[model samples]
Target chain A: MKGLVIVIGRDLRLALRQSADAWLAVLFFVLTATLFPFGVGPEAATLRQIAPGVIWVVALLAVLLSLERLFLADFEDGSLEQLLLSPLPLEVAVLGKVAAHWLTTGLPLIAAAPLLALLFHMEPAGLLTLLLAMLLGTPVLSLIGAVGAALTLGARRGGVLIPLLVLPLYIPPLIFGVGATESALSGLSARPDLLLLGALLLVMLLVAPLAAAAALRQALE
Target chain B: MHRFANPARFTRIADRVLPFVAVATAAALGVGFYMALFVAPPDYQQGESVRIMYVHVPSAWMAMFIYVAIAVASAVALIWRHPLADLAAKASSPIGAGFAFLTLVTGSLWGRPMWGTWWEWDGRLTSMLILFFLYLGHMALMHAFDDQQRGYRAAAILALVGVINIPIIKFSVDWWATLHQPASVFRLDGPTIHPSMLWPLLITAVGFKLYYVTVVLLRIKSELIAARLRALDLARLKAS
Candidate 1:
């Protein structure tokens, strides 16, 4: 537990020191969301209807953009080897890294989601649902993206490879997240969608770190 | 099972089995196509366009089945570190991708006449598309590393992660189809499907499975030979 906290704190401090790295995801999220209106035309009703999907999709892409750097820095600087050699279980260390990733990237995406929702003229209930859905969804993204990041460690063209690997896995969350917001927009019960998102988050939380640690072990070997 | 893990023994057994599998595949497919096109009655609603189901449904089945096979093989490779298992998993992917592609194309062909568009964001089609993407990712990841073993292990891990998506694709498509459109054009699960139609579908499905087995065996054989050639080249380099 102590080791996990220390690892998380170390990653969090590093991320905070290079704050631009975190903001870049947020900026991309906002910019991409802004472009959808232009591409689809500036009609309000259409934007309002498509808002949930557009937001979720761009948020997915933004999360993917930051995933490459998750393990690359440590792997490059040789600290990943030291961490592997440490007494802390590699899974715990992985959980910490994933947590830091969620904090730096997922948290910011969630924070920025509402502003983009507002720009798309989302209603108050829909905006809140979007926020809630993102809160549950983005952690799942970080967790799964951790596995992709770890698997692609030292691989060629990992940046291009990560999205291809991760986006297909992101479909369920994307469906449920957008479903929740769209439900709220239409005055339907969003509970089922939110519950599904929560279930997916819990499942990913359990599975992803172990898989990532295993991938890390393979890469290290 | 463990005995067959030996590649030389497996190859010996597979070489004997391949001819049988090939003959069975050809026979089944020949009969199945004849049955599907000539014997089975056209749908009262869809007319002759219903023939596409024989190819589309079976290809879709192979698409999912191959992914499951890959996942199981990957699990064995990761847990037991069986090199043959790794090769089997890697060899199966492109075949799976091909099946997925055929599913999409035939589906689009059916849809153009039936659904009035070449594509629809309909759940089953979208899920199959995603499955295709997953196969592509697996193939890309398998070749990404310079080290063969490293690439195998990484791709194996990815295969396991992707196995979760299969169920989601199945259920989401089912649920989405049910919610948005109550009666799909083709109803395979309904009691209304006649045995004549059913038998041809079953035969074609079995044929596709046999074809998968035949090709995968050939691929693994080639992969083993390739590995041997590489070893010989390395040894020759060392001697020089």
Candidate 2:
């Protein structure tokens, strides 16, 4: 428990010191969301209709952009090897790193989501659901992305490969996340979608850390 | 299971089995296609288009079956460190991918005549597409790393993680198709198979399975030889 906290705190401090990394992801999210309106035409209804999908996808991509660096720095600096040797279980450390990653990257994306939603002229009723869905969804992204990052730790063409490996897994959360907001927008209950998103997050929480840790072990070996 | 762990023994067995499997594959496919194209009565609903099912259904089955096979081989490789299991998984993936690609194409061809569209985002089709992407990811991850061993282990873990998609693809139709039909996508329930149609479908499916077995045996044997050649070349380089 102590070790986990320490790892999280260490990552948090590192992220704070180099805050541009997190902000760049938020900027990318905002920038990409802005492009959709241009690509699809500037019509308000069109943007409003695509808002849920747009927000979810851009946020997902931003999270992916940050994931490649999650272990690379540690792996390159020898810190990952030391972490492997630590008293902390690598799975716990994985969870901690992923938690910190979510704090840095996923949180910013969620915080920036509603602004993009409003930009798309999304209804106020759906705005809260959008935030709620992202709150549940982005952590799953971080967790799953951690596995991809770990798997591709020393991989050639890691950047291109991570998205190919991770995006298919992202489909469920994408479906449910957009579903929740769209349901709320259509004046239906978002409860089922929210619950499914939560279920996916729980499953990934249990599964990702172990998979990431195993991949990390192999990469280091 | 470890009895077959030696690559030399496995290849010897594969060589002995290949000729018979290949012959059976050719015979079954010949008979199945003959029955399907010539003997089976045309569907009242789909007419000649129903013939595509003989290919599409079996390829879909093979697609799922090969993924499960890769997952099992990966588990063996990861758990027991069986020497040949990784090679088997690596060898099996492309064949699985080919079946997945074939399923999509035949499905598209069938869709064009019956649904009046070349594609639909129906649950089964969407899920099959995801399965295809999963196969691609597996194959790409297998070759992503510089260290061959690392690539094998990492891809093994990925295969195990991706096994979750198999059940999802299996059940996607039941779960998603009826829940909502998008305005753009068409949903059609499959027709019940008459025994006459059933015979050819089953025979074709068996033939497809035999083809997979024969091809995978050949692929694994070639992989073993390739590895041997690489080892010998490295040994020569070191001695020089």
lDDT for each candidate structure: 0.92, 0.90
- CA lDDT, candidate 2, residue B87: 92
DockQ of each: 0.77, 0.64
In the range A74-136, model 1's lDDT, one tens digit per residue, is 999999999999999999999999999999999998888889888998887788888999999
TM-score per prediction, in order, is: 0.97, 0.96
Residue ranges of candidate 2 with Cα displaced over 4 Å: B166-191
Candidate 2 chain B: 10-residue stretch with minimal lDDT: B168-177
Q: Considering only chain B, what TM-score does candidate 1 achieve?
A: 0.94
lDDT of 2 by residue, A15-89 (tens): 999999999999999998899977999999898898898998989989989999899999999999999998889
Question: How well does candidate 1 match the true structure in TM-score terms?
Answer: 0.97
> Candidate 2 residues B1-240, lDDT tens each?
999988889889999999999999999999999999999999887889889989998999999899999999999999999978999999999999999999999989999987788897777777788889999999999999788899999999999888964563345333445456745443333565688999999999999999999998999899999999999999999999
Residue B171 displacement in candidate 2 (angstroms): 5.8
Model 1 misplacement above 4 A: B176-186
